[model samples]
Target: MPNSAAAMSKTGMVTKIHTRIRADPFSAHYELVGKELGRGKFAVVKKCIEKATGKQYAAKFQRKRRKGADCRMDILNEIAVLELAKANPYVVALHEVYETSTEIILVLECAAGGEIFDQCVADNDEAFTEKDVMRLARQILSGVAFLHRNNVVHLDLKPQNILLTSARPLGDIRIVDFGLSRRMDSITEVREILGTPEYVAPEILNYEPISTATDMWSIGVLTYVMLTGESPFLGDDKQVTFLNISQVNVDYSPDTFDGISSLAVDFIKSLLVKNPRKRATAEECLSHPWLNPHPHPHPHRHARSASSLDEPETSQSESEPDSPVPSPDLDDLIGSYLTCPGQGELKAGRDAFSFGEPPFPARPEIQQEVIC
Candidate 1:
């Protein structure tokens, strides 16, 4: 797979990335330093240390061919997105890429902070306060603002995809997992029906055009979940979740928003709008009164701490999280659709639907979920 450039089928679109897939065994350069991080249908993320610098990184192995389809171009689309994020301060850095005959492994800077999902699920009193969430929201908005400024939308922005620089003292957030990211432009529209169901926007379900505003919707969900340790749109199953999102069904009851500030609710309201155009921009979110009430975190204040990196982590980047579906088929359909799917995301937004047989086709029961 030495820089194959098979043109996209109908659009004749060529990837912007010069993905020089190195034909080297990943171990020849990097040493596996920790336990395997996570696994999915076609990908697995593991903690590895660069032999040259002893710097720890997450090595993600993805199949070159998923099912019967050649996915080299789709992967290139993801690489192009990462290249854009590489220039941003709050994103994980993609350091190296190695390819075996069957699999390609992307080496990325390791974020030891684990996932924000961990904090959201924590029952401890100190896990988060309104102020803590505001700070985290600001950080997320900042990174998202940068990406949006560059005309990219991170289609997946759940808590599981956001990582902390450190777990203790609840460090500054670093946006990871760009696998589902897409570049937006005034001339062309990107549409796809693949995302973790809970955070997906209405436009995606409708197969409508995607924009930076799409990322804003997920931010709204993330903020809501962070403020109250509950999912706003999740239901008994995927269909229920999709229906809730399609109809803009969200819980704002006194019980759900107990002790939460009205400004915070307003902030979520501004973002969770059914129409993408009505949703607030990342920059607007940063200026919202909810986040402004507290002095937003200064960039230098949240530097990565060595103590945090030394701690063992249980975070898994590739596994489907928060899907209430009992069928493993749906789980794979949700998470494995993207590469790595780490907090440092690597999802594809190409016309991969044209590929021969989906990499991991859902059982007939869940196939409708994919087309939705």
Candidate 2:
């Protein structure tokens, strides 16, 4: 039965022979080759090629079961969001999906440029100019707007999830990873604390109702990291980081904003507000002067010179713990941040995985009822 093919009743149609059938359905169409692009707790993304067309793709091979039961719903939800937002230029495309008895393979668009965080770190000398940030931010907002229009909320919007099409100067970006995404009605509330500790919104930490504004808050954090290499709410430890986010303890000191433009600062301020209702919507962000500055012959001048700003120094004693902290132990902290009174801690032992070239970070699950 595993390799059998069913025939449909035909009134006046001819059946073709050579109908492909294989014990492993994935191998029948695509050939997985080359080194693994990335790895996670339950999945490995490898480079794959279409047998017929020789087209390349990043195939994410995920196990159907995590502990015992099938955990395919998360993957299915991700697929749904991708299908809804496929037309958006900034969102990564899901080409095809193949499932076997034990695994599900998702063929995704090959992002050659890699993660935006890596690009930002690598380009320390030739830092991104204001125009570059503006263009990238605009494209990201366009993607967010499209997702919002489709009633999709990308709860986890971080630099690691943003990829470039190419390594060229200011190449177009593609937003990947929907592990924490959810589809909801505009008026309904999503109540789950499921996002990276540093970039997650305060509303999420407080276990308050969530909406598209949650994504907007993360966008603000992304903007901060994009402009300044340092994380705005990063604390000495994970718990401290969560407290910083809950308290909205953002450091917009002169040191951090020394060379940054006031308009750009205003744009970030608009999104990072503690009150989710007060945050700027993605559509509104597109019109912000920071993103749509007056055109000038020397547009680069609008962004303060990167050379004038001193890189913020971090002492190991400030961030790292005296003793090594186990990676899995952080799950407890995440559970504390995510769990509310009625909702128990989200099922643990689930590896937070992304669909990038290499697995970046495991995303936390947020439980919410879908309105549609």
Candidate 3:
């Protein structure tokens, strides 16, 4: 059966491939609505509405090339990681995919709330309340736990990649972006030295073996960023940033991190251990005192309301509430990033249809997993 946007919440917590969907690629059954969310070097994400169900989604479109490039492979790898992560609630959900002559489209669930980075960058002294941080941290750990169990390592874990569906009464938090993800089954260690320099683990730059622990280091960075509104490591150049990480020369002044709880700081210290072997696992992170939700109440704040962030210019009625719904235009989603294809040798007849069923091969163990 085709899953509607209304059914997303239930699906978000379980893994089940939509086998009923087949080759109706590029059909216009759905209506594109709302504003474009964001764009990358090779793809664009637009907030959209499914005409059939009146549901909102973020549609990512990657132009198809006769021959694939590193950018295209990165997108494919992201799809693979999302497939492995589907059983977790803390991970974004993949809805549908379509193909046009020029692009491959992926429909995704849009977290109604914006990026966590938006919150972090709002003010220098701004940071999530301890309760809010713990809620988000727990969600993040759940997603990471699911990824590690599937033998997939998310190389890039940061505030920008962490998204929220609802942040009021403190809303649902989820992790996004899998461009740097890799599977452990094929290669035991990663030496590629990829990922944002500031949040990368020390061993990554030293060309040492990369393990699940590497991601834990990034989680530590995330924890710090959530509490302090600043990244732990920063340098004018990549080389300098890497050098600082190797020496473990991070400076954490009490004045610089005012209002941050000691328990939170201690939790970060345990995970940010210079040695990978000493870093906490995702499961261990859940057990940290900082993440204990029982002692803390969910946050209540005076900041701007979520609906006020960027409400559609035109309002829709409640009876036909979706009547005046806005469309997330393709142009808005892509923004100025859409460029002419780069010159490269073209592979003839490389059939885009050959990708098989949408999402390709599904993991057998997905059925038993629970979204964090």
Top-scoring candidate (lDDT)? 1
Reference-based lDDT, residue 132, model 3:
69
Q: In what order do the candidates fall by lDDT, top score first? A: 1, 2, 3
Worst lDDT 10-window in candidate 3 = 317-326
Expressed as tens digits, the lDDT of each residue in 1-372 for candidate 1 is 455443332221236565566886777888886566776555677777788887777777767676566766555656666766776556767777787787767777777657777667566564578877877787788778888887777777877677777777677666776655666667776666555667878887676777889889999988888888788887665566667888899888888888899999999999999988888888777767776654435422222222212223233222211111111133553332122343221111111112112222442322222221
TM-score per prediction, in order, is 0.78, 0.73, 0.70
lDDT of model number 2 = 0.61
lDDT of 3 by residue, 1-372 (tens): 254221111211222224233346544666666555555435666666787888777777765442243233344445556766677666777777675656657777766555576565444434477666776777678778878877778776766567666544346666776655666644344454455556778776555667789999999987877776666666554455556677776657897567777888889888888899999888777666666534323232111122211212112101000000001111121111111223111111100111111111233321211101
List residue ranges in candidate 2 displaced over 4 A: 1-24, 186-188, 294-372
Off by over 4 Å in 1: 1-14, 294-330, 333-372
lDDT of 3 at 49: 74
TM-score of 2: 0.73
Error of 1 at 200 (Å): 0.5
lDDT of each: 0.64, 0.61, 0.56
The clash count of every prediction, one per candidate, is: 11, 2, 10
Compared with the true structure, the alpha-carbon lDDT of candidate 3 equals 0.56
